[model samples]
Target chain A: MSFSHVAIIGLGLLGGSIGLAVRAELPGTKTTGYDADPDVRARARERGLADTVLDDPAEAVRGADLVILCVPVGAMGEAARAIEPGLSADTVISDVGSSKRSITDALVAALPNHQIIPAHPVAGTENSGPDAGFATLFHQRWCIVTPPAGADAEKVASLVDFWESLGALVETMDAEHHDLVLAVTSHIPHLIAYTIVGTASDLEDVTRSEVIKYSAGGFRDFTRIAASDPTMWRDVFLNNKDAVLEMLDRFLTDLALMREAIRAGDGEMMHDTFSRTRAIRRSIVALGQDDPRPDFGRADHE
Target chain B: MSFSHVAIIGLGLLGGSIGLAVRAELPGTKTTGYDADPDVRARARERGLADTVLDDPAEAVRGADLVILCVPVGAMGEAARAIEPGLSADTVISDVGSSKRSITDALVAALPNHQIIPAHPVAGTENSGPDAGFATLFHQRWCIVTPPAGADAEKVASLVDFWESLGALVETMDAEHHDLVLAVTSHIPHLIAYTIVGTASDLEDVTRSEVIKYSAGGFRDFTRIAASDPTMWRDVFLNNKDAVLEMLDRFLTDLALMREAIRAGDGEMMHDTFSRTRAIRRSIVALGQDDPRPDFGRADHE
Candidate 1:
């Protein structure tokens, strides 16, 4: 709690919110934020996202006790390279990037002797930038840490405690396992959403217009998923290509079977499949992953 | 708005909700409801979904000024045939089914002597049955009317007024066009969601478990979609096969292009498609089809 300073790299929602959460949740914690965009830096300072906002990563991290990277996955390497020059030997460096293996490698090479603990907080909205940050973005969400064996145990413990204080359920695993699990869980799903929405976008102008108009059905869901930060998702697919491609292969195989069922007018097959998927929703509700409101949008039902 | 007698057939969410909405919105309306299941009718009356509930659909339609058929699309014909005998010659008969083409056709044949105006309220949640009745589910949603040309204008006008009072934006079109529009809008989208969730459900145990656990990423959205009423969706596909197939053709072509792009590692194609889809989302927000909440999780964001 007495840490002299916590530096947040990239004044996007994740970084800005972490700064805000640390400020409010861990009062007396001195915070500084850095971003390549000077406008974002100014906004962060104006919004009191941090006690200090600076253009240079080194300026933000200099003499800081902890440095947290919260940039797009593709930017992690460059961010680490830029911050390495000023990172102290004992600074606990962590990240909220989606990919773990690639980021951990970049940080290790950038700051050879510094204590680095790669982490990913599985909480976010499609929105981006400093102004979108909130004080409780990570509340009740999961945060996974992929620390290499023999890494500084005290730093790992402190990082876990930090996320826990922000209402995150902290878990630890290796980089490869994290990538594989997330491939099925997140990457492939996002890609499919992007693919479907992209499909609808390519329709004739009239058809596309109607699609947007009547999107309240199911296409709107895909659009919401498709609207996620493209650069971040692009990097996710590229960085996690192996796991993504594997998951996609399985998905395609299953989708092919479903297409066949529909083509053959196999109601039994369709009904059974639809029914099985319903159980996962029940489990999701049980796990408190859903809104818990029975009729989410149709509150009149109550 | 004193409706002396209002009869709602089928006793599901739509039927029960019609009773609920009308009772609350149009005062002094004596509502009656009927379902094949005696227990459902008993509960409907007990819960005040209707002032009177009957097991026989014909009995419920007796002495009623309005008779609403609220059964699943596939069952509409049978319900129409069964209740035709009891429908008064001057009764304004309508339906709350999803697909309009088939329902309108069934009503034309089965209730030729009665005034039938097919209606579909474009609002509902995953939950169903009498217990799921709500007084305001139609608020701010659309209620599309597919009245046969030269049908009694007074009856249509009265129905429109009733729906408007229930908070629906009423629009009228031919049943064919309605089917086509909803095919692209709702039916095909539901089919795709069911297919994708089916695909996920077929994954190996490890991947399947991971899918449910990490569904928050994007797949969960599809699951919520796929979790919709299977009977209703199945009938929608069968009833609106032509339009659904047309939309499916377009979607499949688009998906094939995307599949090839991913297979060939066409990064530019992926990036361009993703960027294009984002505009549709902006349009949906502009149309107020979506709540501009950064995330579509039904949460009120500040």
Candidate 2:
């Protein structure tokens, strides 16, 4: 069964984008959105983020067939609990959290009677909040729908159908595997970007202005991801601690070897490593996962 | 004094770009280009990358008032030596290498009598070679000109004026400071991107296909830089070894602290660090060093 009414519990980039996408792609579906902050609710209404903007989370989800919590990963449990009173017994609950395992556990615990199917749409710009949402955010993006063990097959299919209707390619995976994959793909990259940007800014020898001025060399690429939402990333690291730490340790080990290679002036080893990484980039472009244009076509847009 | 005929050795991205930029922005200036690789020279000729594409490096620089060596950093000395037979006594020699001090020393040692000045245009796409260049590649980008101590001021002014004529903002500094600043801005950033991309690919648990598929989460940003010309990056790390090592150490220290915060569940630390990095991205945008649009406007183009 398709969701006739979808309730988005957070009116941020992901939530607002879902509301906008549903409206644009599925004209029959109605969207209701609510944010804990009243200012966001007002802005969402002004932007027409949903069919209706409600103040109370329960009121927003009252008659919704699908309730997707779009809060920070650490706040998923609280958001689920807030919408519990209004959720129907058959409402297929889901979330757009980066860490699947923790979000799945928290959501199941908070709404025991609801069918919780957590999913993460592997797409976003560096910007966030209500103003950052766009209808095409999920177009041509991957949305991993992670269902709990023994989840209702019909509901899972319905959730997948809903995401597909909004132009996302859905993949079903267990939460444990999803967390591990995302740790390597998402969390560690973010951590490294954050670390390097901080390192560049904190240098005594290189002034911040110089770093900003000459960033086009390569540093600006890191700054784009580094500017992502602080609260959301903080929760991602905290919620997916084990997987993040594991991936980070692996990355650190590899980085240490690279350091040694550079220190030893092993040009051959560095050249081999650098050359091997290019194939993956080509594959990413061939698979249509990233922009094929050089500099991500930034110069063209300018 | 302005150069009536400018010669570019090494018909790759930077050299081809300089040739095109001079042709587009300085109509009166004549351009001659040469590359050691016959294939690149053929391609550069087909693209009309310069007014003339010569097979011999010495022939290419014969009547030019200015000759810029645009080879990889490791080959600057040899490229300088190759063009020595054609150099006029008053020819102002310059280079576009990422590492300034080394290139300056290499150029000076190879051509002791020539007025050698090194400049790095902090601009490029990940893709390289002759076809990867464009006429507007240097538009609004910073071109750092590092003249050695006791260098002729008129020759330096000519070089700076030439870059400015091609729509670049020119800044003059000593070679040592230029190396240090770029080690933080360019070399280290590339080293980190190359390292992380390599790390993600080698993980047995996370298949290379999986990393490529889910790279949109953040890993894709690094891949753009990681996919940069491997030989060029290898030389960058080798030539700027001291500054790269020092900066890498600082980044490692900061990353370790972040690792502890993640392990300890210190959300506050992560939040503050993430928030602080946003300002740098904003400043970069304000200064026009990067594309201000989100996702570098990739989604819109799609």
Best by DockQ: 2
Tens digits of lDDT, candidate 1, B182-259? 776677667777776766666663466556666666666777777777777777776776777776777667767766
Model 2 clash pairs? none
Tens digit of per-residue lDDT, candidate 1, span A164-214: 987777889899878877776677767877876776666553377667766
DockQ of each: 0.49, 0.80
CAPRI grade, predicted model 1? medium
lDDT of each: 0.78, 0.91
Docking class of 2: medium
